[model samples]
Target: MSPTIEAISAMPNGEKPTYLLVMLHGWGANYQDFVPFAKMLNFPGFGYFFPNAPFEHFQVPGGRAWYALEENEFTGLATSRKLLLNWLTSLEASTGVPLDRTVMAGFSQGGAMTLDVGLTLPLAAICSFSGYLHYQPEFQDNKTFPPTMIIHGQQDPVVPIEAAKKAQDELTKIGVSVQYQEFMMGHEVQDPAIALFKQFIQDNLNFN
Candidate 1:
């Protein structure tokens, strides 16, 4: 059976999409949470897809998460990875955007999911903001990986800046080219981070 996904999309200049940017939202947030940010990063000749998580948040009404926060995060991550991959495949089929021209990105838990699934796929680039690697042994092997960038706030009380550092080290150990940046903010993607992300996209992915 095909997976059902609900998302918000924005096309560059209202023209046919040449590339895809998949943005995932953090826990306790809905798909639309990232729509504005996606638009800020929207470059010409690229399309954006902001997909809602499959499960509803336990506490926040109208909020969603890729998986339950109360459960083992690794288990949840594994399950979310499968569901996201399936949805991505169906989306590609429907949109006619090849997987190679796609970039995956997210913030916080969404950022964590980006690392979880994006690294495993044949995507052009990956970006993480306030995200962590979630540290799996299997993902730490030498291979040609998609170019990746991670941005985190140094004062982030929720995820901590160390998570991004660890991710950078592990990705480097695995021979993945990675760029790491830190901001002075707390648990947020600030303007500077977005600027860096925009540059990361232009450097690593092709939109024109």
Candidate 2:
């Protein structure tokens, strides 16, 4: 059985949802942290689900993480990916939203999860902000990958810009359509990235 996960969600205009936008929060943060960010996304006719990672109770009180970075990074990634997959499977069954219509996005470690988990799944699109790619043999053969956007800050101290660039390069090499953008700031989201993000979603996520 999959581990129990908690999430916060919002629908456009308080009506039924047509599309799924799953946004993962950074490490040491909780689900409620992204509620305002979701509002800023402003995707019409889409329901947003901000799932708190199972590994909460860390760093700050009530902060969560997808995996333990201090331990074996590879093993942690694999374990967290499994949890994300199971949660997504359950979500599809309960909400009737196909994975193909879902957009997986994240920030920091959550962005890394977006790249790790989203690449393997048949989602509509994947957005990675300050994320990196971990090369796996299985990923080399994926043929049905979705369009992706990688946004990173040039001065990111946590996850370097090179890591995000590596992700972009790797995705492009596999024939997956990828867009990369770099801002002049640090490790957090800004207005320029948000505008580009909105445009990317508008162009890619076709709800028809």
Candidate 3:
């Protein structure tokens, strides 16, 4: 059986949802980190899921991490990737929303995972907020990558802005439609990014 990561879900008060948005939080942050986005980026008929990372942070108390960053190496990326992939692939059965109607997004470390496993799945769209790529995915003729938005802060220090630029070039090489953006900020998502996020999600997902 595939492991199911714990998650927090939010939905508009209505009937069954037509689309799903899965938000992945950054390192040292729990699933609750992005829960507010569900309300702040309210979309009718769209349900949101924020899944907790599989491991507890080794240092930061009350924090969670998808994988450990230790000794300048990614210690548990493979495990986190597998768990996230399994959880995401199982979403349709649990939510009654298929992968084609779902969008995956993340921030910082979470953003890296978004590009990692997300590209492998048949999602409707993907948004990487202040996110970077871990490594370039090998080209696969059978895999169809969804349209993607890679947005970053020009002044970002946590994950440098170059990460986003590098990601753009790498993804483009693989034939992925990329919507790239840069903001005059640092290490976080602001109003401008949120605005683009709203527009991007609207353009990509099907709503009832």
Candidate 4:
């Protein structure tokens, strides 16, 4: 069976969609986490897809997680990446949008996954919020860079600001065109971050 996916799509009254944005949610959250923000975006000809993580988070009832978070285990990260990739492939098959016209954006853990999948896939852009790139060193020899925007909170306790900075530095070292922004908040996404996200999409997607 195909993976479960929840999506919201918008197109100008007469025009076909030219771009697609995939929003991946943070840990312990479901597809609904991005619905409100997706609605706030002003991409008239862009279609949006928000897919729920494959696993259920232990701590939060009725909440989903990309993978299980266990001590000394990075399996969750790998699992999430594969599942997301599968979902993206299925979405492309159904929507008829080429991978080059697709963008992936995520928050927190989802942000990390966005970086992982975006780098490995042939995507146009990636936007990450409250997240960091953890596997930059591995991609050094691969030398594939996607236009990426990273937004983090200066006071984020879950993922430290220092870690985010380090991730930016590593990506820059490898010639990745990365745009980094920080907000005066915590682990949550703030208005400034959202504004930057909007601008990043508009600039990269060429939405008039």
Candidate 5:
């Protein structure tokens, strides 16, 4: 089955957005988890969309998961990728936001998905926090690599720091432009990450 997506848009009254930021959440979390972060960024005049994962998590109540994880491997990554691609197409069709003006951001598992999916799809930029590269083979064959930013905590237990390095190395090897930063926190997006995110969007998107 295809993943279900829910979008939360914030556009100031009388303002039409030239760019859109799509937020994806980590495993066992839904779109609502990103509400606080979205409001905190407060990117005035930009459209924000937070999409819920399709599947219900095994243990978490009312929680959704993009795909199942087995050990370090996301078991259904391929399926999730197809679902997200279709979701992106649907969002564009419904909102009329061009793909070139769309950016993707996520945390942890969601971050991994953003990197994996964003690289293959045409996008303006991608920001990942506390996420790593999964399904490297898929990325190796992909031709389009959007401007990418990856931020991770040095002490992240859920996704190791080394994973972030490996992702950076792989993307670099494949000639994907990447800006990576390490923070002092763990498995969470901090203020520094937010600052980077804002700058990344401003640099890549014509939102001013």
Candidate 6:
């Protein structure tokens, strides 16, 4: 696995983890941020990995960013994308979980990244919460994508709901099977969304 990004992981208690879940924190958040969040899911027998973004946040002390938000074209995005892709592709070797049984999900900027690299990989599924699509997609007409879940807050102030909708539209146009949801909240995860997320993972994972 690439040593470029630092990460933290956990295995289910009393059982051998049979699947892998990679959670990417949003901009300004560190790997530690998702530790408790993962617990909230109450998922069992699945290993969890939370990878720290490579770059430091320019404004928030002790916070990290996938890329800087200064340029009209997000600077650092390409670099982060490459590093994340490398790390994810190499992950199965270290975790004993193949990409076909792995799910890559994220929030905010990290969610943007979920779509960024997740679209290109043969992951079991990819999910984005309160996230947006960064680039104008240029996929082939017949390309197939993993099962995707896009969730956003109807009253979100940070990332407008429209961005999520636009992402849904674009992805659908490309023949991606997407399950989109709009919750009754803001720029944060809530109970209902968590339930949906859990179900989504269970439904897509190749577990008998």
RMSD of each: 2.4, 2.3, 2.0, 2.6, 2.3, 2.1
lDDT of 5 by residue, 1-208 (tens): 4455665666656477766788899988888888786578777766778888877887899887877874466666777788888888776776678888899988888998998888877899998899888766344554768899999999998999999999899888887899999999999988888987888888887554
TM-score of each: 0.90, 0.90, 0.94, 0.88, 0.90, 0.94
| Residue lDDT tens for model 4, 57-116 | 789987777656554465566766776777787766777788888989998878888877
Q: Please report, in order, the local distance difference test score of every candidate based on alpha carbons.
A: 0.82, 0.81, 0.87, 0.78, 0.82, 0.89
Worst 10 residues of 1 by lDDT: 135-144
Let me know the TM-score candidate 2 reaches against the reference structure: 0.90
Q: Model 2, range 55-172, lDDT digits (tens) per residue? A: 7544678888788765665445666778788888777776778888888899988888887778778898999988776554244653778788999999999899999888887777
lDDT score for residue 157 of model 1: 96
- For candidate 4, the TM-score is 0.88
Span of 10 residues, lowest total lDDT, candidate 5: 135-144
The local distance difference test score of model 3 is: 0.87
Q: Quantify how close model 3 is to the true structure by its C-alpha RMSD in Å.
A: 2.0
Candidate 2's displacement at residue 122, Å, is: 1.5
Pitting candidate 2 against candidate 6, the one with the higher TM-score is 6
lDDT of 3 by residue, 1-208 (tens): 4334899898789658888999999889989999999889888888999999888888989788887765367777888888888889888897899999999999998899999889888899998999988876566786679989999999998899888999999998888889999999999999889989889888876441
Colliding residue pairs in candidate 1 = none
Q: How much is the lDDT of residue 43 in candidate 3?
A: 84
**Alpha carbon deviation, residue 197, candidate 6 (Å):** 0.5
**lDDT ranking, best first:** 6, 3, 1, 5, 2, 4
Question: Candidate 4 or 5, higher TM-score?
Answer: 5
Residue pairs clashing in model 4 are none
